[model samples]
Target: MKIWYCFTPLITYVADTPEELIIACATMNSLPVTIATCGDFGDPIQHPPCDGSSTLANITAIITSILPSDLIVFFKACKHYNLNGVNLPFWRNWFAANPSSFLIPELLHHLHKMFWDHDHLWCTTVVGSQEIDFRFVLLQVWTDHHNVQWYIIGVIAGAAPTDFISAIRALMEFKYLTEAPHFTKKQVVHLDCCLKVFHWLKQSIVDTGAWWGKGGGDKPWAIPKLELLQGVVPSIYSHGTVMQWSTDPTEHVHIRVVKEPSRAGNNHNYDAQVCRHLDRRDKVECFDLILQIYDPTLMKMTVDKAAGNFSLPDLCPAVSDHLN
Candidate 1:
């Protein structure tokens, strides 16, 4: 007989920090970096007013430019950016890894969240939430990638202006392409084309006053996740696909291991209580596995008895006689 333990579920407690720190860690160069500042995009610091003269060539130049932070100059830049309350984080010395490359495409936040948060709002503004919801109800489809792929055109076609519909369709195409299980070289080029089309047509949303600007005018597409779209194809080529490193499983783990366990504990000193609860749960599971390996009947009977609601007397009149 042979037994193999394939996976051991465990949680590593990592202290959460602000977005700035994460960007700093990923790039290793720290911000006011090209990606964060839109410096590569020919946009000034803080994404100043759109000069309309910003040509396609200027826009096309926007690309991911992560430089090595190990350089002497970058150390000063890290300090300037106030990363980690130190000149450089300690992990950089020990972990010789490019996290920025690995940290490429997280589908949950990168796509789904961006869709709901920004894109959905722009869409609602363009074609009114009431009309969109009415269409969705008529289609009997939930809001998801499938909703976008199959029925989005019908949902928004007549309600939205032609350019707005086209822009959304391009974005939807790009989203589905990015989520494909595998991609050929040709598909990658198609992905790029979809993105380009979306970018070019997205100005229509601004033109229609759908997307409001911070300074009280229509804003250009300066969102981080939208910019992150540029790196999706590169990430696919470097890694297998977005599915390989999707954050969905991680989010599931958070709910099962973190949130559920925390709820089991009393509010006071719950962290240690949760840890103890998980350890006990793991031990009980392991013990059950051992029992099942040795004698499957024992484990099966234990589970049945544990799950059984009625006593022996309820099952047998003879048992009641014995008790009496």
Candidate 2:
């Protein structure tokens, strides 16, 4: 069976992680859990949680506490998860779905975004954007993540330290493997190895002070997306290859279904206009389909008749009179 058939896309995108947690909680009918906080600075595992509530850890028990009748635990879990009130999300009733099981790996946002936001930013910071841009301009043109991975190591060679380059290379390799249309058991093992190598070598970034974002200080590497790397293999095992469900196809359709339709409307209350426009379009398409079903040759005959009726005079009446 095709992997795409296994699941349908819902909630195309959310603005950020907080919104994602909201949706995830809503979907599961539970309160949101803030798994990004780091507590164990002494642990070698960078940003390891002191309470060990990394999103990678099973936090479903924590989320489930909000659903019970016990107001005390419910409110306590609410405060712990950083929620405003004891009100349970409306989606807790959704059957057979949880964030961990349902949220498949996305290449564009997960892998590419991580590269651009964290890794690429660090590289540019360390080696300078002008130098990197100069190297990129000289290289042959490539598109998407390939443009970044094709020769990032070669481009930044000797300028960046060996450990930094190795970490990036490991991530690039993991991304490439994840993009494969099909994977073997052996390939899965290799994928895990790539992640392990990345984790092992990523300390160089901390030592050199490249981990420069919000989760700084003892939690220099507390990136939600970076932590998401651990779940990639499990997601693939349960869902299929990452390519099967990547967001690239949805993004490609966004312009046609959303952006272009929205442009047909006035700036005010445009979303309603776009919906109305799409409804009209869908109705017209349905009519066309019904006509074809009734008479398969109708469209072709109409096109032929229209073409035959056209003349130079019809196209250019002034020029046609002169010719006559």
Candidate 3:
């Protein structure tokens, strides 16, 4: 079976440097791995002993030699480039043509401006700012083993649908190929849904000239790119399983786990922060391994659960008496 691997500079928390990460990958002797990275950074490709000339071709050749048929080296589309290419241009043209569109009664109802609650007051100002300062896009990669795993591949500072679209397309292709050699009926359905959504997105861009639909009087519309990507869920259920091939989980990791630690000291030495975090992780992992050898049960408890447990009170006296 083909195994997937992803490479992203954003995963600096895992390794201090791209070279070290590549070395670790090279040492693995199991399933063939795919190394995915954003096209923008020029990392791994532009960094280190690998010459900058013909970098893509050289990286491909090296990975191919290592895994032959099993390696998948994919360069993700650049989010910043895509923002300029698609989103910004569309929004500019549309906004200039229909400045009043944002003020439409239907749109206003959905906007934070109409919110009555004080708690939602912040939303009103943010909504207005979003139009002027549109900057937030994330690209993520996901994989599945016993459980699915996600990683933030890229986080672009712009309002763009292209990055989201590109990620979906890439992931769908990966899912299709990995499940190949043979595909279940449900897998085929899932793939079809992916294609449908992909086509719908392309068409939406063409038809609306924006990522969202042009709302009429009472029907305000906001395009839901992420929601549309969930079109694969029903097919997943039909297939009787779930896969970790989604960005949602990885996004959570970024916000809760990686981002805070990386920015903890508010220090400018980002590289040192990453290195220190990785060093701590390594030590923790090593300690866990040692514990596993000497105290397997303790290790399991530490990893999976707390040390104490309490029984529930007897629900029915008759049942409790029988057990007693």
Q: Which portions of model 1 show Cα errors greater than 4 Å?
A: 1-23, 26-35, 38-79, 82-91, 94-96, 142-150, 215-220, 263-273, 302-324
Worst 10 residues of 3 by lDDT: 80-89
Model 1 clash pairs are none
Better structure of 1 and 3 per lDDT: 1
TM-score per candidate, in order? 0.66, 0.66, 0.24
**Judged by lDDT, which candidate is best?**
2
Worst 10 residues of 2 by lDDT: 48-57
- What clash count goes with each model? 0, 3, 2
List lDDT for all candidates, in order: 0.58, 0.63, 0.32
As a whole number from 0 to 100, the lDDT of residue 130 in candidate 1 is 89
TM value for model 2:
0.66
lDDT of 1 by residue, 9-100 (tens): 22111211124235333333222112343223312222222221221122222211223444554444444433322323333333333334
Better of 1 and 2 by lDDT: 2
Model 3, runs deviating above 4 Å: 1-183, 186-204, 211-260, 277-324
